[model samples]
Target: MARRGKKPKGRPVNGWVILDKPKGMGSTDAVAKIKWLYFAQKAGHAGTLDPLASGMLPIALGDATKTVPFVMDGRKVYRFSVRWGAETTTDDTEGPVTQTSEERPSRAAIEALLPDYTGEITQVPPAFSAIKIDGERAYDLAREGETVEIAARTVEVLRLEIVDQPDAETTVFEAECGKGTYVRAIARDLGRDLGCYGHVVELRRTSVGAFTEDDLVPLEALMEAAEEGRERLDAEAVEAGAKARVVDFAPLDDYVVAPETALAELYEVMLTDEQAARVLSGNPVILRGRDAPVFCEEAFATGHGRMIALGAIEEGAFKPKRVFGGRG
Candidate 1:
């Protein structure tokens, strides 16, 4: 007997789906929804987006799940709006207002502050974030009404441009940054720098790696497609045919990028059939023809128009660190 609302047995759908994650939904909940809609036997996300922040959430299905780490290492772009005059406990709208300031910085004052935030800078992760403290989540500690002091870490901020100043209370901006850079922390710091308490009122992630806003599929659209697939399967079952328990929501090859695409930043090596076979079989292969890139510890090996494995370049040899498809 199946439990009510339990998702049916899923299919091994290997690919990635860019979800324009709606506002007010946790990253975990969004993943669960995407999984159910696709009925994928395996699924994972490249990065976590808080409930308050919406936009691109890269969902990987089946074999694509193996490429998540590579995707997460890529740069992220965010368009966020900060509301001045009040600082929140969480550094976002969810927390209570902790401080308020009557003085708001003019556009010129804000523009002058921009140069200081760009490039490599130290940033402290917000107390209400997923960062672990003493093996427990920092947000968990914060929710339990505990004071969480996070250490400052260096994060590269590639671009920080003021896009708009709609009113006296809010300012909109776009940011391009590296992994581990916290927008909440930026808002908090900006507030302090300008002598006006501020917190993020709205945030939307525009891109993650090669996945961008153009690739995003709305949650409702995916759900509708899945429901239609279920109906078709039920009809087939009535005709004594096996029920279609699995569905590939998007064309894996056409819509979802190949695994090599995610490792664009890494040096790639093309392997012969025999070399690929050995690499996939958990064995190292010698690259006799060319010298490996200097300091190239990580690489992607490709063969037959597909990614074979992610490996380490050690001693002029490609040592398979993690193969794409589990086994040869």
Candidate 2:
């Protein structure tokens, strides 16, 4: 007989965790922490949030990782504060100040420029960004003391408004925009247009797709929950007088959101056991009845409350695009 491969460590936990990522932590680091907390076998994030920014960072564990692309395409809402009178190389407080201006714009001047940024607009990304230049990250090049010129691209900004003005030197604005929109770029451009060079001093993301501020769970809370769960497990093992006991990971279920939450915008179809089996086997099923969707570019199916697959509908037939399996 052929030798069996070593089993992967950790449980096969599946779900989304809308982490309220704190500043100074990278997106990848946050995902690693969450994966360890649940002892999950696999994990990924929907969007990349910088170390200088905080707020909703949707992390997917196990099977939920398959839906990362959908979440990445969802709208993002951010509230950031810009400090006038100086421009930094990174377009944020993280970089050195390269320029300074004594000019300060009135509230009315800021309001008038909001319309220009709203709707479809062309904007250049910050030099210290993740954009690839000749297969190398732009930020890496910039850090190496190399000048990087990123091309301008069009991004959709649904809404932009001045939410607060703390003083003559700072202005806070909130923006709702589509994928690829950078809040740092907005602050940089606004400062330049107002004749007072500025850079982002504070940033916070409040929403992404189906996730909102209400769903955010601070990192401290997750760590505390994990520590408490481990303690409870140890106590139970002691009481039972067992030398060895299997670890139970059910306590952290409360923090895990349904995987379907990321695909809220897609239509959902309920499938029978046989139909679900077919879908899991990489086959399509014919949807029946008058209420069945005739044509849909993207949709999902569930069988007995378990997600079956992500697929497309054509002439009432649901074609499985990506089938899910092995428990959520």
Candidate 3:
């Protein structure tokens, strides 16, 4: 008989889980484990992490899934090690070696090359990446023994440093970059620039947007918490902190950063009860404080310290692009 999966239970879950994903598990698997633990109605992740990569992965459940785009577009920090003198098929340790060299650059040489990678620059995406080409996944094509062509894209590298060079064969680096930046691409390019070849052997993301490593909860811990809280949650029918506790794995809230807190860096607008109601209904309302703000532009809106919506200011009117917390 075919095995059947457990059906999801309870009402919609609305929050984020900053998971400290362990290496060897794919991003989808990590999300599935969390979703099953909470029996959440819906769940998704902000960004995809490679199986070989480990560290902070922010998973969104229910309404928090609406804010995923904002998080994916946010800044990212990574600490990785590049193995010198060999390039791999996948540009990582898991792939077979495609090229080799004995030329290893010194720390000074690597530092001199740092400037080239920093700031806005164009680079090609890896063939074994998730980028789509002609409506098909690039990685799938690469793995199928088909030729893959991933175009060069312009990405912003805010910071790139040669953190350490433990040996002649390895160079460790830390980078803070904007969306669409690929660490594997940097490794490959750096090796080529140094007259040798290189591939990423170790990669770990330290942070993504406002989420940090400190915000992460282990997958096992969350599963255990769900197991222990299941009976209480079923009996209580998910009242009070029931919803939160069911999935809360980090800092008593499962890293569910409030929309207001998450978007704290942006400008805010406080709506009246009537205006909040209007926004909740997906309508725009005029405001008094600002003078004719641009239309369809994004900003944060809140009421009584709670996030009401993240939307746009349109010609002295506030439009609700996304309503958070079922407050609508």
Q: Which residue pairs in candidate 1 collide?
A: none
Model 3 CA RMSD to the hidden true structure, in angstroms: 6.5
- Which regions in candidate 2 have their CA more than 4 angstroms from the true location? 1-6, 232-246, 326-328
Best by TM-score: 2
Top candidate on lDDT is: 2
Candidate 1 vs 3: which has more TM-score: 1
lDDT at residue 42 of model 1 (Cα atoms): 86
Candidate 3 structure quality by residue, lDDT tens digits, 57-162:
9888877787788888889999999999999889998879999998988999999989999999999999999999999999999999998888889999999998
Residue-level lDDT for 321 in candidate 1: 82
| Local accuracy of candidate 1 as per-residue lDDT tens digits, 128-244 | 999999999999999998989999999999999999999999999899999999998999999999999899999999999877788888777776566554534466577885755
Give the distance in Å from residue 308's predicted Cα in candidate 1 to where it truly belongs.
1.6
lDDT of each: 0.84, 0.91, 0.82
Tally clashes: model 3: 0
Better of 1 and 2 by TM-score: 2
Our tally of clashes for model 2 stands at 0
